[model samples]
Target: MDMNEIREIFFQECEEQLAELETGLLKLNDGDRDPETVNAVFRAVHSIKGGAGAFALDDLVAFAHVFETTLDCVRSGKLEPSQDVLKVMLKSADVLADLTNAARDGGTVDESRSRALVKELEALANGEQPAAHAAPEPVAAKPAVAAAPAPTDSSGFQPIPFSFDDFGGEEEEVLMVAPTYSVTFKPRAELFSKGNEAALLLRDLSRIGEMSIHCHTGDVPTLDRMDPEGSYLSWTISIKTEKGEEGIRSVFEFAEWDCELDIKLAEEAEADDERPMIPVPFDLSLLEDEPVIGDEPHVEMHVEPVVAAAVAAAETATGVMQAAAAASARAEKKEAPAASAAAQANAANAANAAGQTIRVDLDRVDRLINLVGELVINQAMLSQSVIENDNNGTSSINMGLEELQQLTREIQDSVMAIRAQPVKPVFQRMARTVREIADITGKSVRLITEGENTEVDKTVIDKLAEPLTHMIRNAVDHGLEMPEKRIAAGKNPEGTVRLTAKHRSGRIVIELTDDGAGINREKVRQKAIDNDLITADANLSDEEIDNLIFHAGFSTADKVSDLSGRGVGMDVVKRSIQALGGRISIQSKPGQGSTFSMSLPLTLAVLDGMVVTVAGQTLVVPLTAIVETLQPEAAAIHSFGATQRLISIRNSFCPLVDVGRILNFRAQQANPVEGVALLVESEGGGQRALMVDAIQGQRQVVIKSLEANYMHVPGIAAATILGDGRVALILDVDAVVGASRGQSLRQEMSLAS
Candidate 1:
């Protein structure tokens, strides 16, 4: 709508382009030699450079210009995209992102970082290996790329050479003479609309050699009839460069599809120049001023004499003739509206069939979700009211209530789905994090991500980065042994860390596993004792000992380091996960490795749950955790210890956990035979029978965070409002199951087996 709005849109597009750039570079790093990938990477930087030039973002344009050059070499196969090459490119992408942010938000990036990257990129383009760490020096300000004039020596001396081609070339003179080419680029409106700039294109051509560009305006229409979207401008460029027509055409490679581009040897196009044309030659001398040398002509006219017969007709105009003409004109105007309406209808239908989308602000979607949550509550309340007042008779009111329930649930789900987004961007950031950690620790590590496209709530995704990043740093710094240690342990020198996400039940499970020397139980136990977190003689299972690292102020590192030993990482990770209504667990092997698994809800807004009464207190068990509900018979219940019990189903025994006692709703365990047994699964591949007093039917309820609204309860995940407007606790199935096990979970599990 306006310049500022358009600039903001350009910056928004820069973010997408930056993401694509990183993705394509990562593909190349992963040994993908697909030509399209290289092309895509090149186009991203090129697009940024073009857009930056449009807004006069000099630093961005300069850096992207240099970055794009190296990528061009890679795209054209002039330079091989080896591991080292990609490493440089990845860092360059980071710098480019910083530059973009700086352009948008008004800040400065590290001059040293940008300057060093510029030098390395330049060296790579020149077919030289980049230094591991190039020192930064005082570099020129980001230049506004345009048709730069010929270079001069440091002494400011310019060289002048004369070509004697007209008199026939001598052998010595011909060797020094460069071939010339003529290029005509007439851009359609698509070019400008798509963020490509004509000035930037001409500037790219100028890089090849000395060039003169002409602005052709003969096709421009008069102001009254002119279309703002029309394409009436064209450019004819004449250049003499050492690299011939091939080099010249490469400048327009990115724009070939959106513009009419033709390139040929200068002599081949000499005949076309003879046609009479209005050309405005661009002056390259004034780099600080506009390149165009003339104002645009808005209108043109041609004069002719009026005929005598026309004047005679006007003097004798009749009423019948005027009436007939008016009627005819009115009829023509009346028909136009019907045809126009039909065309508009057809366009609308085509768009609907295509299923196009518009971007809505996130705050609006959030408001919609809140409204939908209110709608769900109201629907439930209405249903509850009808059940209490109506008799056991069939009625249309009952049927209508059923229909309304289904529709409301669907609307809530649809609204929540709007906030769902892929976790790939976070995973990509983790890759960068891995790279940074690897550099810091000097460890040869490979990060493998799976199911990065798994979609989750945007809120969950936003908070996931911190915890994921901490885990990644721990995996690299403490989980993975150094290269020499890995080799000594009969493992690959480069340790592998695999991060994966998948939907399990109704939750998204993210597991981070590493291949290296696993957790050392002896060291961990010793550290726990030293930190006074556990008694020296305390007996703990391997799982318990391994989990000690998650305790506050506990670190197994021999000495303090930048990555760890601060005793805050894993604990912070645990707390952050807990804050999101998620649970995390750890499993480790002596020599193999360790795996940390996190289970989180798909959306924090609402969840399906089974409403049950525990010790006269209403509680909800998440539907996702329940495998099946069964009534435990006296024959199936058996006591393992004085207070421990197990329920046998289909020849398998699962621990029996009383929801009432576990949640402190009652002082004693509930009767298993008289009540319903919910067979629920936990994240660690364990099943338990949760005993509840009575079943109150299943319902979808909006999740209000207990910790946020009130305080955290050990076995209760969150709080929700019931149809009767009573507050009920949502059971944290994993926490309850885990608490039932206590220290004897492993021993009881072994006994059951």
Candidate 2:
């Protein structure tokens, strides 16, 4: 295509390489000393450098070259991947990523940081120790040094020579003999159609060394017989280069199946005394005397002397060329088994990938999901219409509609599955965030991740990075204590933050737990009082004290630091998670540790909801949040004060919240006896009995974004269209529970008054 498209592909591959580089480096940091891992990391940097040079990205090329050099030392065992070294390498990786991004998008990286890292990398590569925290020196601009010289328009398919120096010792001493080879290349019509240019291949071939080329026009037809798309041109090239046949073959690897190629060693030059001097046809004037083979045209050339001499030379070299060919055949036979084995392994890998996955444009998948959502809504409407028209449930139309409903649900589920992706990449990104934050805070922290392969909807995973990053930073900044403090508290000097994800009850649950001094309850309480969030004598349980951190404008830090204490993150974290139809809660124990748990919906497109009527309006409650539904007995209902009510289930009292009242559907609370009690767990792990007017059947419903099309309604996650074509509000269970608690507290104060 165009150079811009090629550059875009190059950058996309750079991203994949960057990910691979980070993954390999993280593995090394985790104590994996596998030699292949280092090689893979080095290859990633090397590949990026090679491509950058092709595009003349000088800054990227220079940085990647320096980074690759240091990585090579580690790969060759000249440098050990000690903790200190790994720390520097990890920082260097981040800088490399920044450089790559800057190259792709017009931006600048922190030059001072990159210069310092380059200095450190150079020191490591030279087997010299670099001073920690050394001031960065100015870096001079460097020209792009490509791994292989770029081809010009005149030369084609230049092969880069592979070095054997890395093998070391005598292999480096053995100078490869430059061998002359005769190459015949005839491209098929498909070659040019596939964007393979003969001139480009010739230009690359010229990079090897000196070359002599002969164009054969004997196959060309007259104007009347010529076909524009037909292949008529062929070339015989003679080249002398130190690179082996494999290197030469690689030049044509892209079009191997699209052309006819034959390569063999050219005959050695004969001495003047050993052979008669023959005047070879070196110019077009000599071809005037040669007869062309084609029927359409004829050219006569007088080359009787040259032909006779060439026959004599060929006869003399017949034995030699035959021996060389036999030897080459033997070598091929010797390497056949190894080559076959490698081919089998690669084929198996390709087969596995082909069977398991396909790279599809995300926009296509999104469109498909939208279509499936529409199908689900249409099916629901049709089912409702059939039920309304047919009084008897046994009608054939009703049965067909039920079947259609089941099929639509299956299709929707299958479509959602296409958007589900494992959270490992996001978790891997968080690992880097943790390292950077730990370095900034001057704290020794280790992040341990588990169940990183747990799958969630792609949209959920994308939005989770922000909230997850905030939590991870908070864990390092606020939850984990300093190394000295941790040791003083009889804990390990290096604090551990455990990030885990798993599927729980049709939802994804992620937990970030830190092993350090837990929440200081007294400090939090006094801060809440000082901030006017609570009174001086406000009685709050430990759970309530822990949750006070999530309140807006809440912070317990004595002084603001770069990492935190601006009272900005925790509250925003809560709001963002709630907006995703997810819940975040805190669990802290004095002097032990604390865990922040988040529960999120599997997908934002649709949800399994329990339909219920509240204040004469239909509402859908997420089934994942409901533990059980029960009819409250008269004796089980108790009023603690004038307005606060509790439901006794299994001898335990749960705060009874009227859904209609909490959502402002009604001005007054509904009677507990007349409604069904839904025993649901709130975001904070507390159980509450939600009182609704009546229970309707459960169904899967498509979620429509109310906040996008209209203003966001509090206590309502989103709006959806029901089977009857009426709009129904989907309950934000956590928000409603939170609102109910606030109402209950206000009611208690009024009763005290």
Candidate 3:
């Protein structure tokens, strides 16, 4: 092990701790305050602080110390989380990320921000700042130590006394217990610098216990490859101690992060001492032909049947005497059934065993998806070849090829499933955002999540966080109304923000709805004009005006506030959704609330699209947006205004646009209504009939980002590879429809002349 290895462990533990802190934050603000959440927050901060102390990161330790103090107050119910407290905690999280990054980089972090946050936290803690520059009395400090006995050099196993088989595998276990209890502990990456040693701690504990040691050498590097500074070995030890649980826990009071330690009482020490003929060593280099404790011979006398019967009779007599001596014996035995039932119920409360979480290296999942994407391409080619060969009467190869195609398709689906993750974590994050916004806006908001287990690609899930957080906050601060306003409107005192996720038509749709005051159309329009997002006299539909908020710095907040007057968050949300090759739309009524729906492709690597030609240029349109394709008569194209082309489709007059003109591509003709009309529907309840040269059928295409290769082109969501190996830009139907509407309005005004 080397510095790089240590760095990796530090980064990994930092991520896990951050996730725990985030989950705790969500639970903290889940409307109902749970003491467990505060304890969780405290534990998370404590772990980080301990880890930082071991790494000799004074800045990190100091910052986390303050954070832990504040959380301790919450844990003890001395201070409930107010908006101010949450803000400080959020800043503390930011500091932790910075400190972890700094430690990994072998540098120090700026202490100014952390000090400011600590000052605010302390203010709330004591209702004032510590008496100006007064030196406080030092409290009694416990000896910092590793949770477990130190592993001998070049050993790999950490010692634990408990038989953990009864507790199940090494997954979720309660780590925070009262003090003085012993736990076999392993400190995370940087714990050694904190002046803690497993050996020293074990030695101190031997005052109360008889101890034996063994080291696991599996993780030890070769002598020539070993780094003196790195901890490569873990240990397993057997200890008999009289100290209560808290006393044992105190040994590892300052070292827990990144380390894996397990502890259990030594109940069979006598049996262990009597059984083994060979003695396990206390140090390494005696690894060859090491003592095998379980294989050693133990004396077992075979008893005659009569002798066994007599011993059994004596044991029965002793049992009867004990039962008769204890009056509570029968009562206890009577409660045996209930006790067993109670134990069974306790088992159920341990935790849900059903995949609470699964960890996968993201790079591996991405590689699998990339391979699946290539398979999809090859499958398309095979299908095409099979169709051509079948038409040519090659029956034998066609049947085999068809089977191969099906298997390949199934394999692709299976690979995609590996990258799918439930979006519950994302929804939970949104619940916290709602709390934040409610506090900021002086409103009451309750979050209700539906279909939280809806699965999507990891890539989509990653990109969705920012956008969803912003949207949820927007719904609370801007979409929801004040408590008085809600009460006046005969609504519940607490407004509801519903965050839902579902799969529809081969895509994931996330909807954030708020039962607050709906979008004030006049205010949005007026703000749009003031911000130069729209002309003062411009007449816009509610949908169009509502979208202006997504424009940078287009907030309708009357004044700058803590929440969102800064105006960067919503714009970021819109851009992030767009970057994921998704469309976001808003729907609102005057009195009712608003719904922000984001429809995202399941995977960014591949998609099903319909190929259409516009002015001889092939373009791919997502099949999800296409309702139907029609070959309309030329006479069916009617002019509502100078620029608005209307086509009668399914007995309704729908606006028609030349796809080439919308994309700013070369237009061969204006009225190509007889060619092909794609009846595309936008997310914002608008319909557009796009005119193209021809329909080239539907096929799955590999999606390549325009942003990766070139700048993002407006009206183009992404570019994909056609079957013929040509590049086709996918039409952003929503943006194109909006553009067409704008053009139609301008043309109609000109036509009045």
Candidate 4:
């Protein structure tokens, strides 16, 4: 490909490396002292620097070099990974990510921040203690020792040193011996196809020591028989380097499977009396008639003389050849067991990845899902037609249609599964958010996450980030009390926030809970009255007072800060969630803490719904929201006021809401005794008996966005096409209940009037 494409691939890899870096640093911060973790973090930064240097991204290269140097010190155990040190590293990771993003997207990072972090990193690298507060625990301070000047490459960037010395002192001495080896390498066509350049490999080999190479062209064919993509050349090389045979082998590690390679130690000088003489296998005159391939005809004829000279030299080196053969045999015998073990491990890995995964663009998956949705709709229409034509349920056409419906449903489900992903990455991001916010608020807080592997639709996960971020910030800034206050309240000095996710029924429920002083009810109630949101002496319940926080422009903070209380309140969070067909609620205790729970549909494309008729119109209620359906008896129905009714179920009273009246389907409320009552739980964990005219069969229906296609209906989540080709509105249970409560308050006020 062209340079631009290569640059794009580099950036893509940088993203993966950045993620790995963050994950490793987080593990270390959590008290995982594994040396491999530090190595991994260092490697990520090193790789980024190498690639950035190639692309002329000087800023990225410079910053990453310094970061990598500090990480190298930690990797080598020269620096301890104390909590204070980890904190600095985490911030460094953030800054590195910012630099990467700025480089990719055409922007600039804060120079002041970058310079300050560089100073801190350089200090740690130089073995200097950090600020007093960040100093490691005192036992006895070791005298500071200056680090050796790191070796630099042609680009003037220092490479992290790697040596066998780290493994053992004896191995280091063994690595110092200079040994010569002869290598034969023949590339297969696949090597070049995979973007592995032979010239680049040769250049890397040249870096180790001196080398002489001879190219063989025996495999090349005449132009008529030539395949442009075929491999037609091989190379034999002699090299002497201080690095061991393992180092030489590592130079071709990436291409080993794509080439034929052999290596053997070159022979040492022998005494004059022991020299063996060998005769040339072919006469020099025999090669003169062979037609040679070269850039010019004159040059092509010179190949005969070159071949003659090479053959004569080989004859004089018979002793060296014999020694190389012996070395080859010994090397093979020594490597046999290790090679077998490697082969077995590779087999196991291949078996595990037999069903390999390939990344597909999300737009393609979304298109497939849309097509499946259309198929579901058409299947429903066909089933309806078949039922109408074949009046008898036992008809062949009806049975076929039923089978077709089942198959279509399975296809739709499979398509949706392709779009489902775990929320772990998003949750990990929240941990960083918690740290940054805690630093800003000057509070000691810890965020613990559970059930991060809960899978949800990609669309839902993408939209959740913003609202979840706001909630996490709010929990740190407002939900948690100061460290001193927490201690005074007989709680741990460091407040804890627990974030959890789980699949409940057919919905994904996420909760953010904090262990700190809970909502102050009196403060909230008085604030509501002072803002004219509620009348004085309104007699609001504890739940109602807590929920007032979600009202538009509501805040308990006396002044606005960077984190919250700038007129944008929980109401925006509620609206955003609701827009995704989700609901959020709050529960608070006096001194314990508060929990914000959000329930959202698994997928927005299709839903399992219970069909019901209200005010002579068919409507759908999400099956997940329905607790049970019951027939209301006369004795079980009671009227508390002109418009308020309650239903008694299992000796417990629940508010009864007429669905038709709430949706404006009818001007007057329906009689509870004549309609089917659906006992359902609202967002706030309150039960409500929703009155519907009758219950119909349940079915899967494709959801079409009402707001996008038309306008937002107050109580309707979305519209769907039914089997009879009629449009049905899907009820938003939380919105309907909210409307019912507002209606009740209006009636109470009118009564007082």
Q: Model 1: per-residue lDDT, tens digit, 1-753?
A: 344544565676677789899889989988999987986787678667655654557788788878876887676566899988888898899889988999999999999999999999989877643442121121113231222232333433221111111111111111227887788889886775665656556655655665555545456544333343446657676777887777877887778899999888888989877332221122211221211101100010000001111111111121112322332454446422111122122222222222246557888998898888888888889889888888874678889999999999889878888899999989888888888899899998888889989999998999999999999999999889999988898889988999999999999999999986789899999987887877989989888888878777778777898888778788888888887888899989877999999999999999999999888889999999999999899999999989999999999999888888876668887779889999999998488888998899999998898877776667778998888898888988877888887833333222112
Best candidate per lDDT, number? 1
After TM-score superposition, what is the CA distance of residue 431 in candidate 4 from its true location, in Å? 2.8
- In angstroms, give how far residue 384 of model 3 lies from its true place: 4.6
Put down candidate 3 lDDT per residue, 1-753, tens digits, no spaces: 333333354456666677678767755655548766775666567666544432345666667767776776666455778755776786677677778788777776667767888888877767632444221122113111112132323222333221111101111112233222223445443665443544444444443443445433345443334333345545455554556655555665566564676665544333333221111222221111111011111100111111111221222222212322231333345322111122122222211121255446889888877887777777777767667656775688777877776787777778878888889777766755665566667887778889988999988998888888778777887887788988899999889888889998678899988887798889888887887767988877766777777777778888887776887777788778878877777888877898989988888887778988887788888888888888888777787765667898767898878878876676444665557888887766477888888988887777878988987677788887655556788887777786776634233212111
- Note the clash tally of each candidate: 0, 19, 26, 0
After superposing candidate 3, which stretches have Cα over 4 Å from the reference? 1-3, 28-375, 378-400, 422-452, 465-499, 514-518, 527-537, 550-573, 590-593, 612-617, 626-682, 686-695, 707-715, 735-753
**Candidate 4 worst ten-residue window by lDDT:** 294-303
Error of 2 at 235 (Å): 22
lDDT of each: 0.71, 0.70, 0.61, 0.70
RMSD of 4: 14.6
Q: Write the per-residue lDDT of candidate 4 for residues 1-753, one digit (tens) a residue.
A: 344544555576677788788889888877898877886787678667645643446678678877876886687566898888888888888888888889889998999989999999988878743354232222114221112232233332222111111111011112325787777789887886665656556656755755545445446554334343446566666677877678888999999999998877766322211222211111111111221111101011000111211221222122222323333454446422111122122222322222356457899999999999888888888888877787778988778888988899889888999999988878878988998999999999878889988999999999999889989988899889999999899999889999999998788999999997889999889888999989996988777788788777789888889988675757777777877888787888877999999989899999999999999999999998899999999999988887799999998999999999887789998888889999888766477888999998898999998878986677788999998889999998877887677634343222212
Stronger candidate by lDDT (3 vs 4): 4
Q: Write the per-residue lDDT of candidate 2 for residues 478-587, one digit (tens) a residue.
A: 88899988889999999999999998778899999998789999999999999988899888888778878878778888899887788988887887787777777788
TM-score for each candidate, following the candidate numbering = 0.75, 0.68, 0.57, 0.69
- Candidate no. 3 TM-score: 0.57
Report the error of model 2 at residue 137, Å: 35
Best-to-worst order by lDDT is 1, 4, 2, 3
